[model samples]
Target: MNEYFIDTNIFMYAAGKPHEFKEPCVSLLSRIQSGELKAAIDTEVFLEILYRYHHINLPDKGADLAWSMMDLGLNVLPVTKKDIEISLYFYQQYQDRGVLPRDIIHAATMVQNGLETIVSVDKHFDIIEEVKRIAPSDLI
Candidate 1:
């Protein structure tokens, strides 16, 4: 079984009802649940998911979904001082290249957690070579 650091967007698309991407989300999530893949997320991604959901008027449900992910053994990788420093360095390095703050956090979190792959639809994950970026379709 492979371990993956799940991005915020995947969780958002998975839990949001009436989403057109539901099936792919379900399939990927099932992989995580069955231990065919282990999914991990840090506070940065969690906060992103929460904000995105809340912006869409699903604040309460977003919080609930976060807990549900925890229940499913999707480990919550915490942020640390070293992670913050790493993120800062990444931010400085890529700031001129137009990398956003959130992406830097995600990249740093993935590296700090020792995660090898990131399950994401976001292309920014490709910027960091420390981790392999796996699209949702790649999971198939």
Candidate 2:
């Protein structure tokens, strides 16, 4: 079984307003909850969710969402200083590839945790040669 890194956007799309990606992302999450898909997420994912929701005056909802994700039973990896350092290295190399800084950090977390695949809707992951990005639709 291939282990994938669960990107923050998966949770966002699943929880946010309805969009083209909502159903597929919700399905992807269901698979993870059912243990049909093996995945993990780093601490940074929680931070993003918390920050995004808090900015919209939903801090409690953000905390609840974080707790919900934690209850999914998937492995939660840490984002160490070393991961940030590695992200910097990736930034220098992929800066011209249109990769976002947050993505670089995600990639670094994946690398540090021995993961190579990510479940996300972000097309930017396609530019990171070190990691593979799988769309939620494709999985469901």
Off by over 4 Å in 2: none
Structural similarity to truth (TM-score) of each candidate: 0.87, 0.95
Q: Each prediction's Cα RMSD?
A: 1.9, 1.1
- Whole-model alpha-carbon lDDT for candidate 2: 0.92
* Prediction 2 TM-score vs. true: 0.95
Per-model lDDT: 0.80, 0.92
Clashes of each: 0, 0
TM-score quality measure for candidate 1: 0.87
- Name the top lDDT candidate: 2
Clashing pairs in 2: none
lDDT (tens digit, per residue) of candidate 2 on 1-140? 88899999999899889999999989998999999999999988999999999999999989988999987778999899999999999999999989988889999999988998999999999999989998999898
